[model samples]
Every structure is written in structure tokens, then in C-alpha cells.
Target chain A: MNRETAFNLVLAAVLLAAPVIAFAANEPFYVALATRIAILALAAAGLNLALGFGGLVSFGHAAFFGIGGYVAGIFASHAMYSEPLPFGLPATDQMPVIWLVAALLCALAALPIGAISLRTTGVYFIMITLAFAQMIYYFAISWPAYGGEDGLSIPVRNSFVGLNTANALHFFLICYAVLMAALALTWRIRDSRFGMALQAARQNEVRLAAVGIRPFRIRLTAFVLSAVLTGLAGALFADLNRFASPSMMSWHMSGELIVLVILGGTGRLFGPVAGAILYVLLEYALGGMTERWQLFLGLILLGVVLFARGGVVGLVAGKARYD
Target chain B: MTEPVIEIHNLAKSFGGLRATDDVSLTLRRGEIHALIGPNGAGKSTLIHQICGTLMPDSGSIRLLGQDITTLDAAARAQLGLGRTFQISSLAPDFSVLRNVMLAVQGRQRSSFRFFGNVMADRSLTDPAMKALSQVGLETRAAIPASELSHGERRQLEIAIALALGSKALLLDEPMAGMGKDGSRALTDLLDVLRRDTPILLVEHDMDAVFALADRISVLVYGRIVASGSVAEIRENPEVRAAYLGARP
Candidate 1:
């Protein structure tokens, strides 16, 4: 294997091992932290597909993330109270069913948002996306059905037929498996024909059109797919915390997702994982020391942007083959 | 007479107050290089844009192989075998020379939706891409990124892309802009070979290359075609000499 692939494999092993060791050492809290990294890494991996490979700067991914969380929250709430949904569908406490619904709903939400936002490029694209996410964020806060600004809580952990998800170690393993699947999916897409067209669109839209590939179509697909993955992560995130809140859909959450992707690496496959690990660790380490930890985080971000353009992955694996 | 591969009739475009293209009409026949020559701001690029579907003509009709394609987008027109190179050398800078050509080959095949199969290992894509690169004498530089190539090489790479697209009609806008003497000569020879199957609408300033290769020449000035004829006829036209070729010609 090449250096990058080797580094990625080592990263995957470490992520898996850290959680297992935590479980063995009776540090379920540490296991929860590892789970948070996996879920955030999965969410950032979704964004990386569009941001890094397709060059879409979507500042609205929190919409999808929140949508996923609400899907889990709304369903689990209905299951807990034994109430049919507003649409008259039976509520499901099943994680797989929740994930599927989350993916579908996120895709539905992303289609219109991406279609509108993609019409404008660069700063306009960023603003429109941020605007759409804020729209959803406000909608969730005002809609009191799922507790609104107060959020909804899961009294019991959602079921995963084969395992007791209430167990921290089991839940971490599930999140870890999902993260691996997402990373593999990202790798496959980077090598696929669709991926080629997406990257081509990123590099030169005119050249892509000259070759007969519609940049709009390619980007929309990536955006939608990205939403589905992030949406899935959102469901898992809500389950991990046993709560779904407007905070999940907040603009700050959106910024954090972007931050995670950048901290890891923009286009590198394992970039988000590294970024998530560093971000969570920093939040844990620095947040304990001072309430103003973000100040330090900002300074480190500046360092990465100015000196380490490739982010942590670039530092570890060297420059990407093509740069 | 060769059949016309592309027909642009009564094409006109105005950028606010400026009349960029005024009633420009041209035909690119099968098996010929139809060269478009003009001075600066003479609307040559604008005309190319309209034909390629990037710029919509205020009033015009474009046909590819007798089918009206006036309403299609640039990508649709390309899919219908309308290939073009930009004046500014547009390329996927991070993609390798082979991958750049492979994109065109894949575009022609229209299988960009395949998400699982590895395109690099797919011989169907690499074979045609490699063939086109070899045709343009760039097979040796296949692995190099487009960004790293010299100016002349980028032009060659563009031609390779057009070839890989299997274009029935080709639009080459200043294809030899940065080409050296030998590079231009090699390109002239390549274009001569390419025209045997795909007709070309060439917009160039290199008069020697134009004179050496054009089956027909159209000279534009102030957004109008002042003269259109054979090399000998255009060289002798008094209006063309006075307006463009200058007093010495």
C-alpha cells in the first residue's frame, strides 16, 4: 500500500482500538467520546465528498444533520408515548429503520436547498446555504411538537436487533462500523467515474462542460449523497446523546462540521477522522481548563490554514498524489 | 461538395451596447478546415461561443449534422459531437493528461453515472484515451498532471480531448496561441490529419498556419464577415488587404 493508504489503515485501527481499550478499562465515558468522534467523523466525511472533491462549499449541512436527529427524535418519542405520527405512520424504535428514514428525508431536504443554492457560486453559495440551514434551525425551534427549543429526549436507547445498544461499547462499535463504511464509500467514489466527473467539475466547470458532463447535475448528486451520510450521522449523534435539540441544527454546529473537515484535511479520505479526533480531544482537554477554549482553537485553525494547507492528514501522509 | 457538418446562420449577439456578433454565418463542411480570421474585438470568440452553445445568440440557428441544436446547452451540444478548445486553455489542472482525455472518452460514452467501477482499470476508457493522446504525440506525458504541462503541451492535450470525444465537428479557438515554431508545425500537420474525418472551425491568428491549412477562409472585421474564399482569392481581395492584411499584403 501507498503511504496515504497505510496511514488511513493505521487511523482506522487506532480508532477501533481506542474504544475497545476504553471498554476493557471500565472507562465507558471514554468509549462515549470515541463514539462522538466516529459520528462527527462520519458527518464530516459526508461534507468532504462535496467540499473537498466536488468543491461545493455548503454551509447548510446542519439542515441535514438536524433533520436526521429529528427523524430519530420524532420516531423514538412516538414509540415511547405509543402515538402514531402526524402522517399516521407507525413509529419505529429500530435504528436501521431510523437511519433509512433519516437518509431519505435528508435527501428530500437537500434536493431543493442544493438546487437553489447551487445556482449561485463562491460567497453567494456559502451565504445561501447558511441561510437555508438557519431557516430550518428556526423552524425546529418554533415547532413545539418535538419540544421545540427545549428539544426531545430518548428515555431508553434505540434497539439494534442483534445487540444491546444501551451498552456503551456496543454503541461505539456500531458507530465505528458506520464510519468505516462511509470512509470506504468515499474511497470508492473517489476512484469511480462519477467521482472523476465530480473532481473535474471542481477543477474546471468549463472543461467539464466541454467534455459533456453537466457540473450542476454532478454537484447536485454529490450534495444529495452528502446530505444522506450526514443525516445518518445526525441520527446516530442524537442516539449517542439520547436527545435531539435545535442546537443540533444551529449555525454553530454547521461551522463545527466545516471546521472538523478542514482540521483533518480537505479532500483526503481519512482527513475527517483525524480532525474529529483532534477536535473532540481539544474540546475535552481545553474546555476543562477554560470556558474560552475556542480562542485557542481559532489560533490553531489559523496555523493549519497558513502553514499546514493539507491539514493533519497532509502532514502525516505527505501531499496528495495530484495536489 | 462535402456535406456540411455544422451550419450557423444569421447568428448575432450583443453585449449590452456592443454589437459583438452581427449576422455572422458560416458552414463547416465534412473533411475540411474552415479557418476564421479576425483582428482584436472583431467578435470571433463570441461567434464561437454561440455556435458551441455557451453564449445564446440573440437571433440565430445552429445545426449539427442537419439537426437544429440552437436551444441546447453547451454540455448537450458537446454530447451531440460538438467538440471545442478554449482560447484560454481550459483544463482540469489536477487531472493527469491521460485522465483529462479519459474524461472526454467517458463523456462520449456517457457512462459518468457509474459509481462503483474503478475507471482507471476500465480498459474501455483508458484505451480510447491513450489512443487519442498518442495521436497528439502526448502518450509519453500521459501520467503528468495537466497543470504541470507546458503551454504548447496543454494545447496538444486539448486537441487530444477533442479527438477522444469523437467529435463530428470541432471548434478550436486559438489552439496554437503559445505554441513554438515546431509545435505549431506539428499541430498544423495534426489538424490536417484530423480534418479527414472531423471538420474543424478554426479561429486562429497564425496567418502562415491559416494559409497552409484552411480549405476555406472567412475574414471578419467590426463584427462582419468582410471576405470568405480560398487562400488565393482572400490574398488577392483588395477589401481584405486594406481592412486586415494591411498595405504590404
Candidate 2:
């Protein structure tokens, strides 16, 4: 196989195997570390659908990610207290139910945000999306119903069907599976007709209109779908940390998600995975060396932007054939 | 006569102080190539924009298939069977030739919202796109990225995309702008055949291609139609000669 293919395969293998090896060595912290990478990568993958494929540079994806986290946090808290959710739905600390709720909430929130943000383009679009996210962020911080700025903590790990999700290895496998499934979905979208129209809209909206595709609708749909996926990641992340707070919706989280996508490769299927792995590794490696690790990270990001036009995937795999 | 495929009446547009499209009226009938020719900055492109719904006119109306489309946006007008090509080639440069045309085909299909199916393996979209590509003689190059195509090939790809849209009428803005002698001649021959199935409102500056293919010619000067008639009539019109053709020779 070619270098890119080989690199991609090895990367996937290492991500899956490293966690297993760490669990066997009785270092459960490394397993959690791997799970963190998968969750973050999943979030970035969602943003890539809109930013990379749809040419929509959203600066507010953290809104969806945070919403997802809150969904898990709120549900688990209500269950722990033996209280029913509003509208008479009983709270349950079940992973599938939490994921569904998170996905649904994110979809509902994304619809209006996408509809409004899509009416503008360029800087206006970026600012509008960021404005929406910031609105949510401030709301979360001020609202005291669920710990507000302090955040809510889950008493225990949520349960999955026929499995003890509390086990680090078990939870890592779940996150890894979800990440793989999301990667498969990304591959499907990149090669599909809808994907083609989305990519076309990014390249030239005028041309897309001339051929009779409404760019606004295509982008909005992509935006919502991206939010749904990111929201799912957020739910998983809340479970991983056993806590959720306003920090999840911060603009920095959104910026970091965008960075991960760019660091991997803008439009490649595995770009988010590669980017997340490297970012977490660097954060861990560099943070241990010095408290001013961000300076080094910034320098490295500048280097990638200047020298490697395609991010890590571009450096390892070469220019994307499809893009 | 049966209604023209597209009818524009007294269409006027202005930019600040200048009237880019001044009371322009034109029609494209079935089985005909109506060429709109003018010197540079005569507002040929502006008038096309108004017809295709990119730019709204200050006054007047555009009707397609006898439906008032004056207020429709570009995508709405396109959905009503209006197809267009830009003066500068406008294709998804990063896409393969086949994929570029496939997008147009998908646009015309019901519900391009299908997200799960494998579009690459779907025959319904690919088949029609390939057929359109073949019609424009670019079928063999379908695998190549559109940006990789030569200038002449890119022009052909634009037409192929237009055709894939199942456009009842086409707005071709300077299709021959950058073509060589042989390339222009080949396109002229293609238009001759394409006109039978879909009428074209061609805006071009290439005199040879215009004289060779126009079933009717309209000369625009400062956004006004100076003279319009059959080839022989246009050649004899003194105003048309003075405004445009006189400067050519």
C-alpha cells in the first residue's frame, strides 16, 4: 500500500491498541486518555462535515458540543436524585437514552442557529455563529438550575445495555467504536451526491445556484447534522469526565475543535482522528514539560499552517485525491 | 407563434449613475440560437444576469415558459428550467469532471437530500451525467479534476453541466471567450446540434462564431439593443455597423 494508506492504518491500530495495552499494564489513566482522544476527534469530525465539506467555517460548534454534555449531565443528575424530568419523562442513567436526548436537543438547537447564521457569508457568517454560541455560553453561566458556572457532576458512570460502562476498558471500547462509526459516516458523506453539492457550494455558490441547487438549504442541513454528531460526542465526554459545565460551551472549545480538523487535514476522512491523537499527545507531552506549553503549541500550529498546507494527514498521506 | 422559451420585456438595471441594462428586450424561441453581441462593457453580461435572476432589474419582467419569473432568485429560475454558464468558467474546480456534471444532474432530481446512499455507485445520477459528458466529447476525461482541464475543455465541461441540468433554455455568456480557432469552430458545430434540443441565448464577441451560428443577432450598445434581425439584415444595418461591427474591421 501507499504511504498514506499505511500511515492511516497504523494510526488506527495504535489508537485502538494503545488503550488496550495500557489497561493490561494496570495504567487505567492511559485508557481514559485514549477515550478522550476518540471523543474529541468525534467532535471535530462533526465540524469537518460543515467546515471542510460544506465550506462553512462555523465558530460556534461548541454550542452543540456543550449542549450534548449538558444533556448527559442533567439526565444523570436527575436520575441520581430520583426525580423525573420536566414534561413527565423519567430521568434515567442509560447511555443510549442519553445519546438520543443529546442528539435530539442538538438537532433542535442547530436548526434555528443554522437558519439564521447561513443568511450571511464570510466574516459575517463567522461572527453570527460565534454570537449564537456565546449567547448559549452566557446563559449556561448565569443559569443556576443545574450548578450553573460550577457545573454538575454525575455520581457514577451511566450504564450501557449488557455492559458495565464504569470499567475504563469497556468505556474506551465504546468511544472507539463510536469514533470508527463516525469515520465511516464521514467517508460515506464525502463520496455521496449530497456531499458533492455541499462541496460545490463551498467552491462556488453561484455555480451551484446556476445548476439549481439552493446552497442555503444544503449548508443548513449539513450544519444541523454536524451539530447532531458533535452533540453525541459531548454526551460521551460528560460520561468520560463525570462532569459537565459552562466551560464546555466556551469559544475556546470551538476554536480547539476547528484546530483539530485543520491539524489533521481539512477534508480527509481520518484527519480529525489524526489531529485529535496528536493534539492530546502534545498537550500531555508538552504540558508535563512546562506550564507555558501553549506558546510551543502556537508556534507548532504556525509552522503547520505555513509549511504543511494539508495538515498532518497531508504531510503523511499526501494531497487528498478526492478534494 | 408559440410562446418563446424566455421573454424579457423592457428590462432595465442601473449601477449608481450608469444604466447597465437600459430598457433591453429579447426573446429565445425553440430551435434557435439568438446571439447577443457587443463591444466590451456594452452590458451584455448585465442583461444576462437580469434574465437569469442574479441581478434584479429596476423595472420590466422576465417570463420563462409563459410564467412570470421576474422576482425569482437564480436558483428558483434555474429550478424552472433556466440554465446558465459564466463568462469566466465556473465549475467546481476540485471535483472530477463526472462529479461536476453529477451535481447538476442531482439538482434536477427529486430530493438531493439523500445522505446515506453511495452516490458514486448510484447509476441513476452517474448515467445521465456521463451521457451529458459524452455529448460534449469529454466522457473520456470524466475522471480528471475540472481544474486540470485545458481552457477549451473547461468550456465544454460547463456546457456539459448545463445539459445535465435538463435546462429548457441556456444562457451562455461568452462561451468562446478564450477558445482557439479550432476550439471555437468545434464549439460552433456543437451549438448547431444543441440548438435543436435546447434553445440558447448566446452572448459572444467572436464575430466568426456569431456570423456562422446565429439564427438571429442582437447588438447591444451601452445596454440598449441598437439593431436586431436575421444575419443578412444585421450586416446591412448602418447603426449596428457603426456601433459595433464597424469597429471590428
Candidate 3:
């Protein structure tokens, strides 16, 4: 690994592990907060693959996030009450199974979305991806099943391979493990052969073609992989809250995903996670300081975009030059 | 001893009412450096575009090793061993010189679907890529990011990337468009060695480099071939003199 990328990953791991290290045996609230950070980070991490690595600014990741959330909500509710699944596999509150279904569903949805969106680049790509998200958003709103706009309620969180997913601290540990694994996986791809091509296409597509590599196929594959990972996070998120709603898939959720990447750092593997931690904490801290914290949050985010070219990692790592 | 490696016959293309290429035909046998020289807007870039699959012709055919590829897209034609170099140095600025070439090598080998693992971990992609860079005398700079390379080095790296793709025929568009005398001479020397292994269709504006490196020459003017022959024959052709060489200062 390049020194910069390796250093950035190391720094992100420390930051992500900080909360757990400080409060490993903490109060339930602390565990919940750490859990929230990992889940949100996972969603943003998926977005990072497309937005940071591939240069595809997808404003529809919330669809994957919400789709993942609904998988948990829908499955947990049925399994708790012994209702059959659409596929007749018997509803599962198992996190692994829920993650699988959500990934497959999100990837399948992203295939057509990517096919259409990849046709256009720049402003057209941005607008088309946003439009696809809005379509899904409206579908969730119009559908009356599972509470329509109100959302679905998970009676209990999903189970895991062990009983560790039951306790708050244990559940937080599972999410943290998954988050770390995802971070490693993402870091590996960034340095991989395909990753080189993806980054190259982002830099100079015409040049890539002269080298005999087609940019279109390369980017489309990255886009799908991004959707799958982001979708997995969505399932975990629904279980954490015991809820699934249109709010999870709204344009705001998409915006929040981008915000997380920008808040931490773009292109850095830990950027989204750092952004997630800082964002949730900011919301929590500022929410306590004042009721109208959103106004201050907007100002802070604006300050970041205007003054901080790199995100939190950039600030911490002294302007990392990672590929 | 053999049919030409590349042949374009009666290739015609027009945008609206203006003919960009009018019945342009050429042949490049194996191991020959064929130079195409023309003034600005003489349809030289257009011809390169058609050959590289960036633009489609209105009619006629292109054959690589006697296999027709008139309608194939850029990537398909590339798969058939047609490599290209652009006028603008197109490369991944953030990637290392070696990784840039490795992506091309990866394209020629297996598909790029080796997701989840680091491609850097795969020696399969980098070994040949390094060999290609070494051939261009850029192996020492392999670790540096492509963005840090000098313009001349980037031009050399661009050719290395094409070499890693294992192309048998090369379509070079103005390798000396912005180079100095020294840089141009270096490129010409490199081209001389490359021509031994690859059939090159050279589109350039440097008269000295063109005259020195080309085994044969074709002069295009106003979307038409005014004259084509040996370098000495082109210099003496009255039609080429009237249409281009003598028309300008």
C-alpha cells in the first residue's frame, strides 16, 4: 500500500475505535451512539466508492439505504410474528440473511439505474441519478403497506450467528466489526488493478480508451458494487432503530451521505466513517446546546465546503495525497 | 511476402454537407512507419479519429489483418490489436506510471472483475506493465504519480500504456504537438525502435521528425490525399507543393 493510503486507513481505524475504546463497557446510550456511527458510516462508505473513487455523484444512495432498512423492518416484523416471506423462506430476523437480501435487492435495483444513469455524465448523470431516487421515494410514499409514510416497525433487532447481537454492547461490537471489514475491503479495491482503471477513467476517459480499456463498463461495475455495500448498511440501520420509513430514503438521506464523505474526507477510505461520527456527534452536541441546531449545522457544513477542501481526515492527516 | 497488416479502402465520412474524409485509402504493411502530414483543418485529426473508432465513416471499409472492422466501436477495434495515442496526453493523473500501464495490461489479460482484492497484490497485471515501461525507459519513474511527470515523460508513458495493451498496429495522433527539438528527437528515436515491432500510422506536424522517421508519406489537404509516395517523392510532388507545402510560409 502507498504510505498515504496506509496512514489514512490507520488513522481512520483509530478514530472509529476511539468511542469503543473509551466506553467499551459504557452505558446503553454510548453503545447506541457507536452503533449509529458504524451503520451510518457503512452507508456513506458505499457512497464513497461511487462518489469519491469512481467520480459518480449518486444522489440516490438513500434508496439503497432505505431499501436495506425496509428489509430488516419487513423481515423482523414477520419473523417475530411467524409471517411467511414473499419468497416463502419464512421471515428472518437474522442479520446475515437480511444483509444478503438487501444486497441482492439493492444491486438488482442499481443495475437498471446504473444502466440508464451511466449513459450520461456530468450534470446529466447527477440529475438522472437524483431522478431515479425520487421515483423510489415517491413509491415508498404512495404504498400504504407497512405504514406508508409512517414506516415499518421492527419488534426486535435481527439475530446473528451468535447470541451476541442481542445485547446493546455486543450489537455495537458486531456493527463495528462489519464496519472495519468493509473499510479494509474498500481500501483494498482502491489499490487494486480495477481500482486503478476506475480512478483513471475519472481522471481522463479518452486517454483510458487509447490504452484499450472501455471506461463505460468499468464505471458501471463500480457503481453496482457501491450500491450493494450501501444497501447492506441500510439493513443494519433499520434494525438499530427498529424502524423503517420514507425518511430513510429521502433526498435528505442522500444529501446526508454526501455530507458524511465531505465532512470526513473524499477518496479516503475512512472519510465516510469519520464524517458519520462527527456528524452524529455534532447533531447530538448541538442539539443539546440549542434547539435550532440545523441552522448552525448548515453553517458548519458550508464552512467545510468553502474552506476545507478535504474533510476531517484531510485536516487531521495534513492533506493526504492518496489515490 | 504478406498482405498489409492494415488497409483502409475508399473510406468516406461527412458531417452534414462537409465531407470530412473523401475516399481516403491507405495500406500499412508490417514493420513500416507511415507518416501522414497535413496543415491544420486538413482532415488529419478526422482521419485519425475514424481509424481509432472515435468517429464512424459514412461509407467504405477498414481491415486489420484482412479482418473487416469498419463498424466496430473503439473498444472492439482495440481488442483486435489496434492501439492508439491521443493528441492530448490522456492518463490517470492520480495513478502511478506503472499502475496506468497495468490497467491496460489487465484489460488485455482477464476481465477487471477481480473485485474485493487489491490489484496491486496481483503480480499478473504489473509484471508485463513494468516491462512495457522499461521499454520506454521510464522504469525508474514507475513509483511516481502520473500527475508529477513532465509533459514529455507523460507522452512517453502514454505510449508505454498502449504497448502494454499488446496492440499490433498503432494510430499515433501528433506525438510531437507540443514538444521541443530535443523531445521530438527522442520520440522519433523511440518510434524507430517501436516501428520494428508495430505497424505505425503517424499523424504529426513536425516536418523534420516526419521526414526522418517515415518509411512512406501521405500528404492530405482539404479532406483529400493530394499526394502520397516516398519522402523525396512527396517533397518533389507539384500537387503537394501547390496544395500544402508551398501554399504556406
Candidate 4:
């Protein structure tokens, strides 16, 4: 069959199977697990915009994700108790308000980070981004205002405009819908004029410069946009779990996001999704079987990187050029 | 007279103890093919680097279309319509040939803040990209990866890329390098056609193509211009022959 036909069939099958798989596993538990996968995938997908296409291997995404989580947790803690937030704006449990704050915070934080990080390329960029993340991670652990190492808890999930977010299954569907919408948006931008320049910049900075495009400006814009998307996912993740922690900002979380992108197929559209599903399943399966499953997990990760050029998407769907 | 596209005055460069470009002055006029020729270690490449803004001269000033542009970076220079092709390396070999040219075209048009969806839908990117490939005569192999193209085709693609950059002038380091007889002929024809609009600064080793295509030839033996005149004038000048031709003698 031709490519378009095959793509249509694959998309149809996946959409058809989503609910069936969620339903077969049971009520809240399976649905909740799927929700977690969707949230993590969303965060990873944001990273993919930079890491996969733009080739910015930033190990600092977790800091943005965690910052987003804290915005939700902090807002809920103040709102549920009818207290005033630091700026005297009444604490808002409204999900839309919280998401906006999270996105803005993430984007603003990314500007300077991008400015400094973008001056260098490849290894230096990676290390500098990681170092900046570490600085924030350390600060979060030290700051005792919101439980510090223990993290802060939200008594209740944030409220959406017309619906209750307290219900587990309803919340699952909400998060899933957002994830799907994000992937669709990602696909659109990847094919747009701006994305064309970003991809070109990634492929050849010198040539791009020779053609009147500045690589620094393009990369910085992409870096900020990528951070904002991940921050949105982080906010959702906090409300889902009813907590936000320093662990979320840790270097390990950043590593896991990178691992997910690589495991699924670095530049493929579904790489983050496939990686998240497989990783979550592996964690669940191995945790049930043994305490030292991480060692085995490391082995599998090595195999994926060394042996498999393309991830599960390549395995099941086929090779995709624009990742 | 129309202003020279590029002008250099008293340009000097020193790498600690060695003088790479010494008191050099030259002008590239509109619609004229200016050629820089010299033997090995004659600093032709260094001077080209200085013009392209990769390296700044320790002393001197440069003007593009009567505006001083000595301090601008490469990207800034390009935005002012100074196009360049690398002498050694090529574009990303892993990406498709169409992709390579599409990138050059995109570099001229978009903001780079884009995220989401397929970039293939942008007609603005495709149109010029196709035109560029057509100019290089590689429209038929646009889908193939750049690494897969033959060496000669890569050279053509390089020119196509410069064309896509929308520069009014092209600084080609050496178009005829490493090409066989047929490849050289192909490139010579391309340059001949290209000179219909954009001026080219040809830095070449091929004496035949240089004599064939250059409107004016400048001979540099030791970072100083020894001769500058029409090709026929240089072919008959004893000083030009003593400085360049006599060495091959």
C-alpha cells in the first residue's frame, strides 16, 4: 500500500483501540495509569520539539516541568484554604488560570537559559543546561517554605470551567484529550514555515546563516516554546497526583525524558508516546517481579540505543523522516 | 558609475608573527566576475575568510554597496545579500537534497519560532526550493539524500544553495575543485549563466576556466595584489607574467 493509505489505517486502528485497552484493564486504575502515560508523553513530546527536531539536547526540562507542578500545587493549597497568594491575588483553584501561570513561568525562565545556553553547541550546551537545572534542583531542595524535600500536597484537584476535576476517570479523559490535541498541534508546527527554518537551522547552522537566518534566535524561540508545552504537562501531572516535589526537578527526571525520546525513536511523532507506554509498562512489570529491576532496565536501555536505530514506532509503524 | 559591491582598503591581518593579508585593497564591481588566483600558501583562503566575515582583519575597512560592513558577522553580511559557498564541507548529508535547498530558502523567510505539524505544507518553502533545485539541474533528484549525490552534483547543489540564499553576489571559493573534464564544463556553464545577474568572486585553481570566465583577474603572490586588469591585459603584462605565470614557467 501507499504511504498515505498505510498512515490512515494505522491512525484509525490506534484511535479505535485506545478506549478498548483502557476499559479492559478496569475502572479507575487502568484509566489513571493511562492518564499518567499521557501526561508523561506530553512532557516528553515538548522536549522532542527541541531535542528531536532542533537538536537541542537540553537536560533541564524537568526543572520547567517541576516549576509547572509547583504552580498548581501552590495555587491549590492557598485556594482550598481561602488564603491570599504572595501577590495578593486570591488563590485560584481554576485550572485554566493555573495552566496560564505555569506556561508563562516556564517561558520566562527559558529566555535567559536559552540566551546563555545557545551561545554554545553540542556538548557544551548539554552540560550547561544540565548545570542550570542542577542549580534550581538544589535550591528547591533547600527552600523549606513549601515542605522542601518532602514537597507540598494539594487537598483537592484544580477545577475546570464547567466540570469537576475531582473525579479520577473524568480527569483521565481531560488529560488524554489535551495530550492528543498537543500532538496534533505539534504535527502542524513541524510542517509550517517556522518549523522549516528551525529544522534547517538544526541541519546546518552555517548554511542557515549564509541564507540570512540567525541560528541563535531560531533556537532560542524553539527552546522557550518547547519549555512552555512541557510546563503545561507538568501542571496537569501535579493536579493528577495532588502533589509537587523536588524529585520532579531532579536530574534523573531530565534523564528519563531524554531516555523516553530515544527509546521511542528520537525524531518520530509518536516516539514520546511509545516510549512512555513501554517505559511505564516495564516499570510496572519489573517492579512487581523484583527490587533490582532497574539494573535490568539499564540493560534494555543499552540494547535500544546500540542495537535499535529506530524505536518502537519504527518497529510497528515504519520509518518516519520528519521526527 | 554604479558603486562597487565590495571594497577593501588597507586591509591587514596578522596571526601573531605572520602577516596573512598585508595592506590589501581591491574592489568588486557590479556585474563583473572578479577572480583571485595565487599558489599554495599565498593566503587566498585567508583573504576570502576575511571578506566573508569569518575572521576580522587586524586593520582595515570593508564596504558593501558603499556601506561600511567590516564589523558585521557572517549572518549579518548574508542578510545584506552577500552569499557564500564553503570550499571543503557540504550541507547536512543525512537530509534529502530538496531538504538542503528548502532549508536555505526557509532561512530567508521564516522566524524559526515555529512548532507543531508538517513543515511540508508551507508553499513558500517549496516554491523557491524547487526553483533552486531547477537552477542546479537537480530537480529530478530532489528526493534523494545529499550524501547520496555524486561529488559533482554536490558542487552544483552548493551553487543552487547560494542561489536560494537570494544574494545578489556569490563568493565561491573554488567551484572547479576536484571535478573531472565534464564536471568542470558543467560548472563553467553554470557560472557563465549565473553572471547574467549576480556578480561572482571566483577563487579558482583552474587557469583555463579562469581565463575563460573572468572579466578581470587579480594576482596575489604574497598577500599583495601584484596585478589587476582585464584578463587579456594580464596575459600580456610582463609584471603579471613575472609574478604568477613565470612561477609556472
lDDT tens digits by residue: candidate 4, A1-323: 74533653464355335644766655666667777888988999999989987889999999899999999999999998899998798888998899899999999999999899999988999999999888888888888888789998988999997777886666877787777777777777777766767777777777777777788888888899889889999999999899998888998999999988888777777778878888887888998899988888889889888888677666666655532
Which CAPRI quality tier does the interface of model 1 achieve?
A: medium
For candidate 1, lDDT tens digit of each residue in B1-249? 755899889988898899899888889998989999988889898888888888888998999999999999999999999999999899999889999999999899999998898888999999999999999999999998899999999999999999899998999999888789999999999999999988999999999999999999999998899899999999999988988888655
- Tens-digit lDDT track of model 3 for B1-249: 899988999989898888879999998989999999988888998888888898998998999999998888887788788988879888888778888888888778746666656666668887998999999899999988888999899999989988989998988889998898899989999999999999899998888999999999998887888788999998888888777776531
Which lDDT tens digits does candidate 2 get at residues B44-133?
Answer: 888988888888999999999999999999998888899888899998888889989988899888446877787778899899999999
- What is candidate 1's lDDT per residue for A250-276, written digit by digit as tens? 889999999999999999999999999
Q: lDDT of all the models against the reference? A: 0.93, 0.91, 0.85, 0.83
> Ten residues in a row with the worst lDDT in model 2 chain B?
B240-249
- The superposed Cα distance between candidate 2 and the true structure at residue B204, in angstroms, equals 0.7
User: Which window of ten consecutive residues has the lowest lDDT sum in model 3 chain A?
Assistant: A314-323
Clashing pairs in 3: A192-B119, A193-B119, A264-A312
For model 1, chain A alone compared with the true chain A gives a TM-score of 0.99
Q: What's the ranking of the predictions by DockQ, best on top?
A: 1, 2, 4, 3
Ranking by TM-score: 1, 2, 3, 4
* Tens-digit lDDT string for candidate 3 (A1-323): 65456666675566556656656656668778878988899888999999988889898899999899888888988899898988688887778888899999999999999999999999899888889999998898888877788889887788987666668777777787877878888888887767777887888888667666788888988888899888888888888888888899999999999899889888878888879888999999999999998898899889988988787877766554532
* Candidates 1 onward: DockQ, in order: 0.74, 0.69, 0.56, 0.59
Q: Give the TM-score of candidate 3.
A: 0.95
Ranking by lDDT: 1, 2, 3, 4
Worst 10 contiguous positions by lDDT, candidate 2 chain A: A314-323
Residue A205, candidate 3: alpha-carbon lDDT: 81
User: What does the interface RMSD come to for each candidate?
Assistant: 1.6, 1.7, 2.1, 2.9
